[model samples]
Target: MGSGSFSSVLKKPETTSFIILVLVMVGFTLANDRFLSPLNISNLLAFMPELGIIALGMTLLLTAGEFDLSVGAVFALTPVSTLLMVQNGGLSLELALVIAFAATFLVGALNGFLVTKVGISSFLVTLSMLLIVRGTTLVLTQGFPLNSWDGDNWLRTALAGSFYIGTVRIYASLIWFAALGLLALYVLNVAKVGNWITAIGSNRSAAVARGVPADKVKIWLFIATSMLAGLAGVISSLRIASASPVAGSQYELEVIAMVVVGGTALTGGRGTIIGTIIGVLMLRIIRNGIVLVGVPGLAFNIFVGVIILAMLVLHARFNKSSERK
Candidate 1:
């Protein structure tokens, strides 16, 4: 009976992901003592929230049977717009932020409109957006970094400011990630809309037959996702005091990997906020660990690619086995 219980526990995808995360942490710590050092840990925590904020939204979209390929471009584009307005357009910072976020919301609304109303596949719609937004960002900046953040504002500091706890430094972005993650957790597990999202992902026809407002829910979700991505970008720009045209390039795949490896299904219908958080830590630790172990920084993607492939295969098998049972 104990063995059977253990077997059942092992069958859970989130449990499997947690085990892998622990193994990686152990392996890295063994490889380099600094892996456990407070300084390295501080640096790792500092890098967590921007990517994390984006991933939280991606988790929701994926769980609702959708994807947003333009999030990466939006991550770059939103901040670029805000900075350009502040630096060159003579707009007040507060007004610039309001306009930038409003534009972000519109981008998501457009993607949702094309997918839900115009009958386009989410992939094709978002892929086209990815190119368009990325191109616009590059053309606006002419491929240069915008370093015109001349003065600090309370808003910037509130979003990404640094503070110390004993010897370790922390950022306000971490607080944002935590608060938003908890809200996402509630959305996935507690709310009526959560059930609606899962129902739509699991079986759209059935959900609609049962009176779920599939299109509206998905459209609102897209808007929320875009807002999250844009917010992360703003936080990152504030932290670094610069907006780079090329920032967040290729981040879509990485964020997806974090969701998938964290035990979210590629097919939608199921996912876990806690698991996704663990997945975020796993990848971040892996990146930090690889550098400590003397691996070339440029080859980090090699590790991520391999992990994504492995997880996809494992999950497919796991899902198939559950079906057979």
Candidate 2:
């Protein structure tokens, strides 16, 4: 490929994402006049931290050429674990949070182990994990929401509650999301581990030959993804002041979609935290716009499906053009 072709291939992802973002914003704004308002933007920002956190991990995982279908279950299970610890075990909120995060990390480690050591596809392993974790949540909750935790105030105030800046109320998770985004950007763009991650995602065998410790990288990605999911779950529970078994149902799809739509290649080796952030914002805004326009919630899924398909088609076209050159 000539220099022009090489540069075009490199620029395609960013260009496509930018186009999609503009279209989403314009379409939604046209659908609902309030979609571009500060309040609606703020609400969309609130939606971002949870999915954004997960997508950060998911982006890493995807860049490493793996998927974690179990994230939704882990997300749901984290809050369940915290609630169980606080309600029946009488554990302090801090302790419960620690235990919950530890459990998620373990789940992630197991996922990495199964995929790398046992040679199982991440899809199968994480799907099985999804069922297992969801079942465990059901068993623990006995199919009921646990509203009995007594330490809601501290937990709520620390992570989920709104922080006021003059007349504006910002969700605390937003700060966490921004911090995580910057951290992820630094890791993926500047850190040694980030280079290893991208190398492994690009070619596992090549990365291994270069002493990248591919398995360890995969394992760490799994742990990171799960830990973020766990944190999101806990913060979400604190925000709501209760834990429900179904609290994060289908979250994996949403997070994965956000990452993929943001220009992360499922086949691996190319993605950006910034692009994923924009993708999350686009999805959240669309969802919020749907409600504002009186569209049924069910229709939001259709919209997401359409967006994902469009992104995939664009990705494929970009690759084909590059290959042709």
Leading candidate by TM-score: 1
The stretch of ten residues in a row with the least summed lDDT in candidate 1 is 316-325
lDDT of 2 by residue, 1-325 (tens): 6998878756667568777788878877888888767677677766679889999999999999999999888888998998798788988878887888888989999999999999999999999999999999999999899975556466577689886665456899999999999999999989999998899999899999988899989998999999999899887777777889987889999898888878888888986888798778767866777788787877877876787788878877887777743
- Error (Å) of candidate 1 at residue 277 is 0.7
Candidate 2, pairs of clashing residues: none
Model 1 lDDT tens row, 97-192: 999999999999999999999989999999999999899999999999997585778898899898998888999999999999999999999999
| Per-model TM values vs. the true structure | 0.95, 0.92
Write down the lDDT of every candidate, Cα atoms only: 0.89, 0.85
After superposition, the stretches of candidate 1 with alpha carbons farther than 4 Å from their true spots are 1-9, 297-299
